[model samples]
Target: MLETYCNASGQRVNNEKSSIFFSKGCPQVTRDGIKNTLQVHDEQLSDRYLGMPTDVGQAKNGTFKYLKDRVWEKIK
Candidate 1:
């Protein structure tokens, strides 16, 4: 569906880097269904997305601090 839409609209979506995320404890059937619907892989909440943590639990652990650190390092 998405690919067809993109084709009709002349817009492209990069499937290689795209993935889907679900809330914690989501049922396996639902997860697999969504994955199949979207034609994308499932990603864990603990995994980082675009250099920032994806889940609130992981955000509180200073996982994103390194991003700020790197920016500051560059500024210095």
Candidate 2:
């Protein structure tokens, strides 16, 4: 699927900045197979994306505290 897209679009994925994310329940063997098949590197997702938290946890306040800080800073 990716191959066809890249072929038709004349654009290829930048492997350097590419990563494959798998569910927590996904087995290591399956993850390895999928990564090998996709020819993409396996990397842990960053805690934040575009300056925002990517995964919200039980502690919502902590996850979003940065926004409050930013707001206060801007207000000041």
Candidate 3:
């Protein structure tokens, strides 16, 4: 589950170096083709994509399993 927020306003407002609006919830994982439909909020923001968790461990608990699996596979 990955969450992303965009700043549609393009005001170049510095949200304290934070690009995301708010993403503390689990994001639904769907096929690439269905991703567009799942994005219910099409509201444009000022920035592009930002504020995503770079580390797998930092992700939500529910999404941790998937991240771990990928990491383990890479180690093999």
Which one wins on lDDT?
2
Lowest-lDDT window of 10 residues in candidate 1? 42-51
lDDT of 2 at 32: 89
Q: Give per-residue CA lDDT, model 1, range 1-76, as digits (tens).
A: 8779998999887766777777778998999988887777845444666666666564564866777789899999
In candidate 2, which residue pairs clash?
A: none
Q: Which of candidates 1 and 2 reaches a greater TM-score?
A: 2
Residues 1-76, candidate 2: write the lDDT tens digits: 9889999999998877888778799999999888888778756778778888888969999989889999999999
Question: lDDT per residue, candidate 3, 1-76, as tens digits?
Answer: 2322335543543334433222445254433324344443332234223433444345467545665778899999
Candidate 3, clashing residue pairs? Answer: 7-45, 7-46, 7-47, 8-44, 8-45, 8-46, 9-45, 9-46, 10-46
Colliding pairs, model 1: none
What is residue 33's positional error in candidate 1, in angstroms? 1.7
Q: List runs of model 2 lying over 4 Å from the truth.
A: 3-11
Question: Which portions of model 3 miss their true places by more than 4 Å?
Answer: 1-59
